[model samples]
Target chain A: MPYVNIRITREGATAEQKATLIQGVTQLLADVLNKNPETTVVVIDEVDTDNWGIGGKSVTVRRKQGK
Target chain B: MPYVNIRITREGATAEQKATLIQGVTQLLADVLNKNPETTVVVIDEVDTDNWGIGGKSVTVRRKQGK
Candidate 1:
């Protein structure tokens, strides 16, 4: 019942990248936590730059300022 | 800081529905956990049926089997 959610900026990540992430994260949990990979669920989310924020500022704005 | 992730099979969920979820979840965390809403991060993932699995089978397969 281990659920892992990975969030990244929407920057054209390929399907293969997502599949690799899923496999790698599952394997990591199995190796470190003794968790069963069969039951472990990994979900990857690609968020829009406008939706991801830092320092109370959206990523889009931060990128525009080159920070 | 509270980070909440809600996952649902991708099925044409409208922008309003997603916004409501973000607001509702943020409010819930504030009310129950006393977490600051400003610090709370809520991400909603609309996953492909092929990517979500249950009982050793993907949601797509499960639906086809009518289980």
Candidate 2:
């Protein structure tokens, strides 16, 4: 059995949207890889922009700079 | 920091393709959300056809049925 775990930052996702997104992604994986929906898990991590950074830049700063 | 983890079933990805996919995904996250590339992690799980199922149906069976 293949176990796929996804932990994504919850940026603009509303509660309903988050649920649907998880469901959609789960369905996509299940459909494409023939994995059991029960075994596939998707996790969301809601973090502050200050806490998340990429390439040595903070998300908040990046957004402000538009880069 | 927001942590995003992805575990995907390796289908047709060559070794180089897999590396590039990881790099691209990491870069995408970094570029979009300003996340540190060092913390972004992507895992790949190569599973047999029988181990993965979606919607209560085996992937291989689904493929056979043209679903």
Candidate number of the best TM-score = 1
Candidate 2 lDDT (Cα, whole model)? 0.62
**lDDT tens digits by residue: candidate 2, A1-67:** 3443445554675677557646665665555445578776776667677776777998789889985
The TM-score that candidate 2 achieves is 0.50
Q: How many pairs of residues in model 2 come into backbone collision?
A: 10
Please provide, for model 1 over B1-67, each residue's C-alpha lDDT reduced to its tens digit, 9 standing for 90 to 100: 8988788978689999999999999998889989999999999878876556444445566578896
| Complex DockQ per candidate | 0.16, 0.22
- Native contacts kept, each candidate: 0.08, 0.31
In candidate 1, which residue ranges exceed 4 Å CA deviation?
Answer: B1-6, B11-45, B49-67
* Docking verdict class for candidate 2: incorrect
lDDT of 2 at A16: 72
TM-score of chain A of each: 0.88, 0.71
Best lDDT among the predictions, by candidate number: 1
Two-chain complex of model 2, DockQ on C-alpha atoms against the true structure: 0.22
